[model samples]
Target: MPTNGGQIKTYAAPEGVAVADAFLIYARSVDSEPWIPVSTYAVDVAEVNTTRNEFDKHPISVASFDMDGPVEVQVKYTLNKVQSAAIRPKSLGIQAVIDGDNTITFSLDRPRDVMLEINHDKWQALHILTNGIDHNALPSDSQETWYFGPGINNGSPYGLVTDGNLFVPSNTMVYLAGGAFVTFKLNFIKVCNSGVRGHGFIYNGPNGGAILIERSENIVVENVTSLGATGFSLTTGEAKGVTISGYRSFSSHGNGDGVDLFCSSDILVENCFLRNSDDTIAIYGHRWDYYGDSSNIVIRNCTLLPDIAHPIHMGTHGNPAKPETISGIHISNIDILDHYENQMWYQGCISLSAGDENLIEDVHIQDVRVERISKGQLVNMRVMKNEMWTTAPGHGIRNVTLKNISLDATNSQIVNPSQILGFDYTRKVENIVFENLNIGGQYIHDGMGKPRWYMVADLVPMFINEHVTNVKFILTK
Candidate 1:
């Protein structure tokens, strides 16, 4: 384990592989963390572009490498104690082929969502024993894919196969042609291990999902666990270094959006936990082969629950132009719990609409704790109707900062903007701040559906708007 600046590798496996016992894989990050794990390294991968080695001196996203390029950087998997037969009966075995230029890095801390779905050979995998069990009577077994640990010999487990199972005959057999559904070029990660021991149920279903890092990336999914799905999607494109943290992107689908900062960037998602149905933590500006933006972000000590949508959503979808580029973003200590349906269609807990004006300056939502908002807006700086595409998230919601927030609404009401709903709305919303915040609620009226914004101290539509500019609010207690 070289020191000076970078180099730490340790893996032990021989204590248990389940009933058949024996496993160990060490280097648990070097004990007390959040820091203290970095050494020097930079053997010259393409002249060391973007400070590749030596762990960038500090916030280099953890997993670093770049010395004269590829050489089987590393790939590992050791399931200490799991296998319990009943793995069906494709053949009861293991095989290998051997090839290089492979780089696999995985790190999940746990909370839910833990999958490794892989089945190859034109979508082949059926050792189905149904339960009673007997993939060939155990004892060590063998099958269509099985490359035992330590050094791994012979075949090496038929290309690759995870958790297992994929047999299609009528379900559109691999799109009805020669068909095939197993070919990973490498770089894949889905870790949600919130402190381990199945904190929530990372993967608890008959059909589970985890290795869905969309396209792929030079990956690192930190302290992970998803407890749900539809969120926790990393997506891949040119594929750059990635780092996500203390995961818990809980979902029920139907727009379940959480921890989805699409396209991909020099990324990093800090301490997380989002329970969503739509927008618990969103950052988009691109689509398809995965574009980019949602920019260099850092979301801190979090806990945003949207059960439906909008706990923190900032998208600049301007049809998909490089996916609306950005500069930077940092949202600190959060604790929002918003409810959705912000009128017409989408809702908000913290929003900034679509793109074009570009330049969504360094954003921040400090020490936040927004609560109880039902089917409507809370902080939506809108101008939307689909302008050019999106990522504009600007129209005046500039140099933003909503610190020490705590908006309430036991059940509903925080409404007030009506009258001039939509018209060209060129947009320019402006330098905003809502310090030591504390609003009671009731002010909605976009067009008479007004239930409340709980207004008592002046509410001229939450302070009118002519594209609104240089705004301020500092209510407390």
Candidate 2:
């Protein structure tokens, strides 16, 4: 956890958490020193009520280390009182050892950020973040680095509003030093070639979004912790060539999406942590004044916890006047920790609801493992008309694939079946494939018999409507 390129530092818990004395976490890359653990609060499962209290009284350990490639992570905790332990995504295959003195030691090789839990739950766990290459390295001859140290500084080149939001300008490097907690929103409007990076915290005050990248290009946001945005943690509208890595965000308010890409292209969001009340990551077309198709987006190696809505939501908004197409979106290696949505129509661990004359195609969701789904379905794909945002139904959806998705919904109350439906023949969904989809220790295949299709009711296990064509389930084991 090196900050400002200086000595490596370990962060203490923010506040109000009883640190466990029986646990110790450490990590190290090939060239860096061993990293110690930092204490942070994890949302208690019991406190996940209708009130949406994000940060509860429960405490967990978190540690971050930088590495160019792979790294080794170790956790030593008391095991006499614990029953079972496991790491999330389930694909990592880490093992544990029982040491003497009632302590348990586990080691795992992490290519990215991951979670470790005892008793196989999110109540008490460890979040280890592996930060990749530094994107904040600017040439010394470039523009002077605007440093916001620990306080309320108002002398920035970009004007600070009365509400403490910073209006970042173009062609500048803004760095918030370690331990610096700035209570402001970073606004990037119509700017290019800029970045916001640090180990500090950016707290977006009431009634404002945390980071807004609109109509900009070649922007990067890295290694920053943003807290409590009323709108979204990080949002991009009509922007392109944006790279966000190792960014951690937490939001508890309504409509507080993690990373919302609206009518943007060539965006990459990776190695991040997002716990939001709304969709963790949403890609939409044409919202407000931004009107166009969204393409070439990749969201990978991230841990998502949706306290309210879908972990991944797409194609909800589009322009009816011109009909936009959202294509070439790939999401891989994601660990969906929790998804809680009350409305059945808008509930899914992953949802692709194409509306408003939008064509959502060439989307691939692969290698995802859902550890727990409290109240939603596994997958939901539809081409329908939205009563709230669309004047017309979606055009068509084609060439979408879901591969190696395993959901352990053993403790979930999944009343509705996973769906792939179309509004009509003219606006149908076509060429959708499901491979190795495992739910509750059972694989979904043709041998399970033809799927039952339902209209306007709670569905069965796998529901494929009439207008969905060329739907194939290729299962292995």
Candidate 3:
């Protein structure tokens, strides 16, 4: 509980909705300045039980702001008791000073998306989302922008808003001002050069998603805070040249996936904070009407906090008959906060389950830090023919590299051993390499001391199963 505060910027939610009292958060630029209050918005997340469909809502607190420089943050837990508190991803090495019984303070040198948990309770944590200063923010009164002011807005000058759905036309720009709450699904369907940029909140009701980009091109969705989406936070299908940056989402429903890309290409998702019940970022080849080979994607510098599922998943769904290829993916510099999943079929913090005859290839995942995986494995690459989600078996998975990956399961006893398996002799996993892989302060490399009779996988806690060829672990450090 460090009492230091300074000049900083913060945002607030709308007036109609009451602020959450779970945590009292403040921010400042330096220790010598006064503190600025940051409103903690109430967000309902799910405490999911995979054995049943019925879920319970666990309300959490979230605060967001734009950081132009280094900032000091202070948080005071307002609950009755707080035995101990912690912040994650422990890989960040952010040390907190406890100045009081219920207060803690930490300093951030730059913008980061982190969670604060009191009494080691993760379900009711506080999410602090920060982004770089918007240098190209649209003016509030710009003639080219459709600005939605503060408060709940529906059926406006932008035209047809029915049943909490708004279809944005082509070449249009929409902005949600600070404290503005829009419950509509901002649909960018078949539109070109359209974007939604703001610092506001978008809430989805039940069936649909918060923001959808379908059959669209050159679309940009930046700096939008999505709250409590029952489905996905932002889903893109058959889209091209899409850029998703500085986005934040908190979802708690059954299938609350974040930033799902289906049969899309040339996408860049960076500097985003996604905390959901399901896969934080799922990339697939084909699903429903979205049909193509999903390729050329880059997901970097993002923080994925999955309360239920994988942080990075790919190649699950595809066209079996035509046999699509899901390739050209690069994921780097990511911090996976938590991954909790009980189902073995869907239990991997970084999973590549190639189903539906999809040939998954050319993937590079590097510079990642995985912290506190409560129930899932660190990695799972398998060629499967799961009838539940696919029609036929996948072709194979090839040329995948995991470099500079670190996982810290300090006190976790439920972490499953990672696996890499092929469906059969025909569908094999080939040319896989783990370069500079570190687990629990020990590097898993070939040159490390190991029994001569033991296999390479015996050096670590993973299983290099059958039908996997050309797997190597090299020490680069």
Candidate 4:
């Protein structure tokens, strides 16, 4: 759909792909132009921990496109059924021009991923994913690039025999062009200076990870969309010097983490959108054959929506005998859309539940906006032994700082308080600070006007359990 100054490109799903009838979507460059029909695909959501009930499935919709610039959009839902409509983060302040009770119109200037809800329905919202044109996409005829053009591409030519897995060798660049649907586990093992880029979708359904990087360095996976993976979508274990930018992932199956790193270091994950049934991004010390400390990771400018678990979870798995350390993590400029978890112990948007004799320290989270928390806590920093996932208690969680963290609970529900606890006297959580923590338009600090006997957590409504020391909230402008 090309206009005078702006253009839009849409991808058709493969044959046998399911299309959604819940909404009709269209796009145009301006108000005077004719609207082009956008393909709306049905994606599974809330299908974990259950028997795939239709009522509980939700059957979310996604409309994606590549745009050159700003564009106008419209969405039409069931007539007279929608009493309300909203688009979030809520910080974006994207107002919809409601046309009666069934249609809404909006404008998008920048490429972003947004959720559109009807009648305040949280589970069955439509995701509008807009991406810019891939200017650095390699040509199809390049010798260094192995290109998969538009269509359903299996891994027959790339050594996919019986396992439904495709291994990309070292020093190679694999490009999945627009409208290409790849159906295999793309693995990069022991490779250097390799990458997989372009505007394509990797659909590895009900199997292992969508893209796995193990024992590899100097690798990048950018601007690629992955959906319907049963395990982690994009994972790195025992790998280093990796960058994942402009990536998108969606999953509904059990243990469907967005970007999980185990025993890895020096990673940068930015400008990504992840909506999953488990943690959106988890950083751990050691797991499986990946044995070492996880350090120097930066995750910024990403949107995370966790339907069943935490958004940013870390320090849960490590070596119990050697006592590994997970340190030097910085997470900033994040927009957490929604977090819903029923289990009390496993419900936090930012959780650092250290276990398996791991020592987690020197972590910082700043400039984050949390829009909705349906049934979870804002933060959970604990060092305890959980028999379900860990064998021993952690050493401690220390030297953590959170700055300019804001949560908007005006139109949402928060059922639990944030927790900070430690295991015993020997293992304590210390040196924690919260600067400019805002909740419901109020900054929670130490000098707030409250009763003299009230602690700082009383204002923020947090729980400072035993063995936690040196926790302070400062009013930093």
Top TM-score hit: 4
**Cα deviation in Å at residue 318, candidate 1?**
3.2
lDDT (10s digit) by residue, model 4, range 23-85: 889888864567877777788766344444322445788877778778888999853477778
Cand. 3 Cα-lDDT:
0.83
Q: Would you estimate the TM-scores of all the predictions?
A: 0.29, 0.80, 0.94, 0.94
> Per-residue lDDT tens digits of candidate 3, residues 273-305?
888888999999888888999999999999898
Count of clashes in candidate 1:
87
C-alpha root-mean-square deviation, each candidate? 20.2, 5.0, 3.1, 2.4
Which segments of model 3 are wrong by more than 4 Å? 1-7, 132-136, 141-143, 154-159
Clashing pairs in 2: none
Q: Compose the digit string of candidate 1's lDDT tens values, residues 293-394.
A: 556677777666565556777655533333354446777867564454534435556776645444355677776655455456556655455534543333
Superior by lDDT: candidate 1 or candidate 3: 3
lDDT of 3 at 410: 91
Candidate 2 structure lDDT: 0.72
- The sequence of per-residue lDDT tens digits that candidate 2 reaches over residues 102-212 is 344555443455666777666566666554444554322235566765334313533546565667778876786544456677888999998788666666555467788
Query: Could you give me the TM-score of model 4 versus the true structure?
Result: 0.94
Q: Residue 249's C-alpha lDDT in candidate 4?
A: 87
Relative to the unseen true structure, what is the C-alpha lDDT of residue 84 in candidate 1, on a scale of 0 to 100?
Answer: 23
